[model samples]
Structures are given as structure tokens and as C-alpha cells.
Target: MTFLEKLKPHLISDDILIQEVVLHALHDYPNVPEEWTNELLKEAFRNKDKQSSIFIYVENQTFNEESVKILSENIPLMDPSERHLAVNLVQRIEPELALKYKNQLQAYIPKSTWALYELLLHGTEEEVYSEYGQILNDLERAGSDQHHLYITAKKLAACLVKKGWVTETEIDLILEEEIKGRWFSFNGILNIYMIGLLKLEKYIPLLVRLLERDEDSLLEELSATLISFQSDQVIKEVAPYLRKENSIIYAASIVENMKTDFAVQVLREAYTSARELDQQDILFEALCHQFSEKALPEINKHMELDYSSGLVDIEQTAYSYFSILGIKHRELALWRQVALERELDFRQKGNDLPSAPVRNEIRVGRNDPCPCGSGKKYKKCCGK
Candidate 1:
């Protein structure tokens, strides 16, 4: 029997046990027919005792607008866990619809702060800033439970940062308030503050402190903030970590953006220091493109080395370097000579090399040394 047929009986039933079974079935059979799917969904929603149906639909990729609207309307009736699931569903399928239900959603704010935070995160910056401002205003006007208000206030602070609305002075004020030692998660508050106040270079010291603390998921943000500076000082500070595998890409990216002669030199040195098996050719290409005139002699020297057996990779690498430097088109004659000589060497070694029309002026005589530096007669190496 098909999977849905097996799930059909439990799906139509009102038993709470059926909720788990339906959820499992949905998980196992994601492509099941909508007809059977809708029945199970309606059953889950109708059975107030079981909220697992909300989860089943949320997890299903096939769940669509009709299902979303039903869940969004019924969200007010759900308990905290179910409410969280409903909010997640709305955020996923219809964020604008979720925004429309914001007032009713606030009722669950004390218990579902993360849900509210996520909704605001996905909402437009204007909407989020406005909502956050209103929440702060409400906190100031009516004396509610300080704990809940503080949690919501912190969420607002984070939203403000992500939207780039918080000023440097505001960031300092928040930090001072956080230093007073409240029950809130200080790290989360500080992270948001850092992201908001990232425009000022003075905050680099604070970012360095956060990075040193090894706060979870903050390293990437710290790296991004550092990269934004795009100054020589920032590049020098981050240079030491380039040898580390995890830091290499970010370090290279920062160096690339710096666009200074020092950065190019560092990349060239790093390229030479890295093992041949390591993927340093891209870094070399980046350096070559950035410092074409300075790198020409080095490129020529490397191209003249013995690489008969590995000429294809070497040629492609050189081509990439030249291409990025915007010098390959001008150096076509030289590259054509090298390519012809390499092709001849491959043919002499019983390797199949495709024949193409010669388009360059550099003519390699039979007795001349191979351009590939294979250290053999041109006739034997590439002229065959």
C-alpha cells in the first residue's frame, strides 16, 4: 500500500496520538497528495488537544497559502509552543501576513520573544524600527513586569542594530545599562550593539575583545567588521592568522580589498610558501592581477620552469593570472608559442593533443629549446 493510505486512518482521527503519527508520516512522505494532506492538516487544527499538526505542515515543503492562512488565523488559540510554531510558519510562508497580525502576536511576546524577534528580523526595516520604537514607548508609559519588558527591550535593541538605526552614543548607553548586571543574556545584547555601532572605527577594540572571548557565531561578524575598515592597519593586524586554514579566506578577502602594494606582496609570499598541493593558485592570480607590472618577472620565471608533465595545469594557471591582470590578450603571441611547444611535447610523449590553427608570430624552430622548459630538443619535445 502507498504511504498516504497507511497514514489516512490516523490522519482523519481526533486522537492526540494521531498527531505524532501524522507528523511522522508527513516527514517520511513529503510528496504525498494534497487531498490526503489537507485532511490530516484540518484534523490537526480542529483537535485543540493536539498541536503537532502545526509542526507537520510547517516542516512540509508542499504546504501552501491556504494552509498558511488557516494557521495564521488560529495562532491566537495556540499555546506557547504551538504559537512559536505558528509564528515560524507565518514567517516562512507569508511574512507580510505575519506583520498584519503583529498586535495580536504581542500577547504572546512575553513567552515568545524569539518568535517576535525573528518576525521583526524578517520584516522591513521601517516596520521593524517603528515596531521597536512603539515597544520601547509602551515600556516607558505603563509599568509592566520589568523582566518581560527588559527582554522585549533587548530584542528591540538587536532589531535596531540590524536595521542600522542605533548611533554610537546609543550603543554606549545600552552597554552601560547592560553592565548593571540584569537577568538578560548580555552576550546577545552586546553582539547586537556591536553590529549597530560597527560604522565607527573606535569600536574595533571592542570587537577584538569579543573575538578574544570566543563568543559563539561572533567570529564571522568580527571578521566582516574588520574587513569593512579596508585599511592597512586592519590588514596588518589580521595578517598573522592567514596561515591558519580557517582564517585564510577571510584574510585573503581583506587583503584583496585593501588594494595596497603591501597586500599584494604578502599574497605573493603566501602563494610561494604554500604547498603545491594546496589551492594557492587563486591567491597568486589575485596578486598578479593586483600587481601586474611588479609581478611580470615572477610570472615569466615560473612559466620558464620544468613542467612538461604538468604543463596543462601550469598553462591554465598562468592563463588565469594573465587573464585577471588584463595582460593575456596583449601577450597572445608569447602564450601561443608556449601552447604550441607544449602541444608538440604532449604529442611526442604519445599524449593526444588537439590541433588548432597557429595564430601568433613566435615561430619555434625544430632545433630550439622547448618553450615549456622540458629541457629537450624542440623537434622531439614539441615540434613533432
Candidate 2:
């Protein structure tokens, strides 16, 4: 038995220190039996200690399947603070289980807004979405509190789009309500609007308005999303921004969205004009994604310059780019060659001598023990 198993009985009474220690130990060693974690949590709930409750909540946050079951069973009976923690834990660990207790959790929504937010954002299994729809309808009708309800609706809209239950039109209708009433931030509304446009690319005019109004960050995000639709109008809309000094980053991002040769040309020009490390890095990185046989010579030339100045770290970047493009190991032999050359040059220049050849030594003995670390002679073990 482990230390936590021995301390379980004492944790039942008032030995808070033992409980905390066992919890911390079990946290470090997650392989501990799920029953032990459940028992300690039950004891903490019986004692009504806030600190122990918090610890269990945190442990549940990091838990696997077995530990999550314990948390779900015990969460409803916990006090307000413990209940909130349990709700948050379930939302993260077992979202389906959390949805099972949605009605019971409704009372805590006002006090536990962040927990609700997490559930709406990431806890979006089918059951969780069903529960969210119920919650939204309930909040809308009852009018108990508007703050959490508005946030929940916005998140629900995003989740609906992701699930394909609601179309871009429905999302726009919701955003129209939100913007008119000043229910949420303009930026938040704009983000959801962009998501809508991403799904329904026909909304390019609206996106152009957002871009013209100086919403650069949102425009950049929208450009990336619009790439899936492969629309030239979107590229044209973002071209003027490409020339502006402040807008260069977003422009490069937009150019990456365009997969055509025209887009590659724009990226090459941007790479030439880009002076900052970050801008150059983004341009080169995007080019690597857009790489083709036709673009290889240009990439090779830029890589040579970057290597001489030590401005670009090529090996890691090349590996990442090739991995994304599904380029095989054999296809990237040129990159491996370049890396080997750089390593050799560094050794020769820095050490003032040619590197010695690496030697491999082989050993064998007929009557000796096997080199495989088995307690037997070579012939009887691996050699046999």
C-alpha cells in the first residue's frame, strides 16, 4: 500500500495536514488508485474544509477518467465554494457528466461565471451543447441576470456554428441584437461576425468594412479563416493594407491565405522589403508552407543569405515546413545536406582543425556473457 492509503483513515477525522499531504502526493503520483482519491474527497466534504475542497478541485482538474468519476459523484453534495469548484472541474474533465447535472448547477451560474464560460467554450460535446441550448433558453425567459446570459449566448453562437446547427445568417442575427443593445464588446461581436463570414464567405463586404474601420487584428484572423474559401476578392480587399508599415504583419498573414501564384509573388516581395526579424520570419515561414518546385530557387537563395548572416534558424524551420507540406524525408535531402555543411563549417572555423572521422568499434567473444545484459553466455542468449 502507498502512503496515501495508510493516511486515509486519519483524513476522515480532523487531520487536515495529512489530507493535504496525501492529496499533494497523489497529485504528484497520479497512478494512485481512484478509490483513495474519492475517499479523501468524501472526508474533505464531510469535514467542510475549504482548503481541502480546493485541493480536490485542482486535483480533479488534472485527473484522468477514473478520478473524474469520483468528482462527478461527489460534486453535487459539496458546499457553495466546493460546488463551484466541482462544477468547474467537471466542465473541464468530464463535460458530459457536467451536463448531466446542468439543472442542479443553474443556481450557481451567477456566482460562477468563469466556470460557465469554460463550459461554453471548450466543454462542447454534443450533450454539453444540448445543455447549453437549454440554459440559454432558460436565461432568456427568466431574465434573472443579463451579464452571464449574454456571454453564454455569444459562446453558444460560436459553438452552434462549429456544430453546423446554426448557419451564418443566424449568427449575424444574434450579433445584430448584441451590437444594437450594447450587450457585449464591439470586438467580441466583431470576432463572432468574422466567424460567421468564415463559414459564409459571401459576407466579404462586411469584412471589408471591419478592415476599413482599422480592426487590423480581427481582419488578420478573418483573412486566415477566409483562405478555406479561396476567394480572390478577399485578397484584393487586403492588398492596400500590405503596403502600410503598420499593416505589414497582417498583410503577410493575408497573403498566406491566398494559395495562388499571385499570393506567392506578393509574399516574395514582402520578404524582400521586410527588415524586422519577426516580419522576415513570418514571410519565410509562410513561403515554406507555399513551397513548390518553381519557388525552390528563390527559397534556396534567401536561405543562403539567411545562413551567412545567422538571422534564420533553418533546420528546425525546414523540418516544421516539410512536416506541414507532407514532404517526405527523401524529398528534404537537400535540407539535410545544407545542415550537415553548416555543422562542418562551424567545427572547422571554430576549432581551427578539420573534425576527426568518427570510428565504430565492434567486440565479440565466443565464451563470454552476452552483450545484451542477459545472465547467460553469448551462444545461449542473443547469439543463439
TM-scores across all candidates? 0.36, 0.39
Residue 202 Cα positional deviation in candidate 1, in Å, after optimal superposition:
2.9
Please list all clashing residue pairs in model 2, or write none if there are none: none
| Cα lDDT, all candidates | 0.49, 0.48
Candidate 1: give the clashing pairs. 344-382, 345-381, 345-382
For model 2, residues 1-384, the per-residue Cα lDDT tens digits are: 323344445434342322332332233232345565556555545555433333432442244455555655666666663354454444444334444555554443444654655565566477556766676566557542333354455555555556566555666776566445524443344355446434566666555444433443244344445554556776676665565566654465556546567776777776777666555665675565454334455555555653332323355345444543345655366665665566555445535532322100111122223333332334344545
Q: After superposition, how far is residue 174 of candidate 2 from its true place, in Å?
A: 9.9
Clash counts per candidate, in order, are: 3, 0
* CA RMSD of all predictions: 23.5, 21.7
Off by over 4 Å in 1: 1-198, 205-220, 289-291, 297-320, 324-384
Scanning candidate 2 in windows of ten residues, the lowest lDDT window is: 356-365
Residue 177's lDDT within candidate 1 is 60
